[model samples]
Target: MNIPGPEPRSDGGVGAVAAAGGLHTYQLRLHAEYGPVVRFQLPGVETAVSVADPVLLEATAHIDKRPESLFAFLAPLFETGNLQVMPAGEHTPWRRLLLSVLAGRPSHERHFTQFTALATALADRWAERAGRQPVELQKDLTELSLRMICAYALGGDTADPGGIVAAFEEVLTEYLGRLYEVPDGGGREERTRRAEEALAHLRATVDRVVLAHHRGSHPDKSDLIGALVEAGERPARIRDTVMVAMLAAHHTTGVAVSWTLHLLGRHPEVAERVADELDRVLGDRPVPEYADLRRLTYLEMALKESMRLYPPGPYGARETTVALALGDYEIPAGATIFYPFWAVHMNPDYWPEPGTFMPERFTPEEAAKRPRLAYIPFGLGPRSCEGAALAMAEAQLVLAVLLKRFRFRPAPEHEVTPTERFVLWADDIRMTVSPRRTGEEAR
Candidate 1:
């Protein structure tokens, strides 16, 4: 079967999509021009296919192996093995273990108090700054998310939370910068040396955290690190797991919360509705409990809608381990299958007025009508995000605390642009915060 795609550029299709517009936007254009199964060019890969249609995606949903060539850039960050490149035999058990800790209701409840307190502390800071300076949504939220993950996953033994967060950011910025650069660049050697230094700093920090856990500095046996230590996992494997968890936990939730706030800021009516729900649910309380999460239906719907429009990690990819048939096209083994999540969410058939920010789109009645895979912000099938439940809990609780305390409005003359750098991030989501008037304040 023949596949439709644009002519490959002579530059080896390096930065082709990115040059057009960001990768996310370029993908929407691809599906618009060509059909759902559009062939595309990716640097360092032989053949790449982008599947936009949800129906077609089911065919390849079962393939769990990620493309090694694509994920190899992350290998240097790990010691024993790269979780991204783990084969099915190892990946299955590893993922299952992660699910046991991350997906459990008990685990979420265990960490809820610390998570809520951290979120409330940030909200309190924002309340103090209301009407003074615009809040940096992504920066603050990323730090909050990082702190929560460290507390939950590594326990409270971390002596310097700020230093650990800084090291992780340095490693990400250095490696991600090099990953996008042309391989034969002039300053490649210098950049590579800097990346190595960053990696060393991150590894040393992780080593200290792990050693503290083993020495009983953190006695919570149920914590993620403690559980692994009790399971007798290797030190290298434990380090890799912790690093990966930090990498996954930090920015994704931060960006998700950032985008949700951005959307709510633009639509004051929706923000008002969310605020109303929080007021009715929590009443005089500043923070939301685990049980309160289920009662905040409007907040949950708005978050789901936000993810549909601006998924934090905009794309997911897998290498075909065996011959696969998708729609009418036959994808050979060893081919790169790209899942353009942003494009999938924007598919018109699944979502009407996909560009419009309508929280009602996610209401239970409305959602039941659409295809299950139509809304895949966290992905689908076996390799889906294990910490998805945890992320939503964090995002919803933070949104509740922040929104109930202050209203967010887009900062004057500061434009928010979504750029892809391992995650869909807005460097500056500049928004003004004004304290919300409650019953007591109004009286």
Candidate 2:
């Protein structure tokens, strides 16, 4: 059956996507006007099919391949290959290796003290600046997230944390900037030269860490580099995997926590409840132990709800390995399955009052009622993020530390507008931070 969409625009979809804001926003408009399965023009490619229905999403879950062309912009950062589009044969083992360490409770426990330190430091700095200025949540939190990933991926003892963070930022600014046409201080030729230099420095840093892992003879599944080394992955692939992890984990986790706090700022009642949970769980302790995460149930729900409202990575894409039946529709083989995460999240059928921020919707009782794909802050299926567990832990830890120490109020003059960039960026979330009094309520 022919899918419904707007007539092919001569401008190759640029004007349309721009008019609606971005790719995900355009997809939402499509699904709203043309129903769940709507075909639309993606700028670089021909027509793409976007499915916003959860049940339909289940049908395509088995498709493991990602369209490599769409992700080409990130290719310069990877050495071995784009793991995002690695063949199923290669990806399966690589994913297993990553998950073994990244998903492990032991790994989380091992790093908890260090992660807590990083978060506490950020919180302490914010406390000092609390009354002085509206803290830039997006900028400050993303940088913290980058540092946390560097520590997690390369270990805290690695050289020059600030330099590593700066290099990665430079690489991203040069590469991602080109895709979105975002201007930078340096000219294109100069930016490219610097980015290449930064990329080399990062790879060398990973190599140093890998060499240490090899020398220590601690190739354990509970450690990220150790697991890869133990699995006998090629040095290049190991570095590529680490790069990908840092790339995926940093901004995404940073924005997830930032958006959650932004929501709490607007919804003081819910923030009060989150604070109550923190109080009851930690009592007098300022930071949560690794075990305390599960007990921070309300806080977890709030984070999940915030993601539902503003997923860090708004959309995902997969290539059909074969012709597929999606509900009433038959999709052709080799078609691009557009996963409009924001639209699926906002689908009224699964999420009642979809636009509202209701953390209770994520309670076990309520969450059990929705389809698995109904809430995909992280993308779905086999090509889904391997760092999912770690990202959650990182976000929760950061949110706990900051929310415990300070109350975030949206700055009076700052506007928090949701625009899709890197992650579903907030342009910049500037919030007034106030040190929490010992017995302060959310007011």
Q: List model 2 lDDT by residue over 43-83, tens digit each.
A: 77654899999988999988889988899988878878777
RMSD per model, one decimal: 2.2, 2.0
User: Judged by lDDT against the true structure, how good is candidate 1?
Assistant: 0.86
Model 1 residue 62 lDDT score:
89
Candidate 1, RMSD to the unseen true structure: 2.2
Superposed Cα RMSD, model 2 = 2.0
lDDT accuracy of residue 42 in candidate 1: 76
If scored against the real structure, what TM-score would every candidate get? 0.95, 0.97
Per-candidate local distance difference test: 0.86, 0.88
Candidate 1 C-alpha lDDT tens digits along 1-443: 88999998877776677676677778889998997999988778899999999988988888888999888878878888789879999999889889988988898998898888989889888888999999999999988998888777766656677777777777777677767663554766776676677667767766776787778664553377766777789888888898899888889888899999999999999998999999999999888889999999999999999999999999988989888888789998999998899999999989999899999998889999987799999987778899999999999988988888888999999998888878888767999999888887852
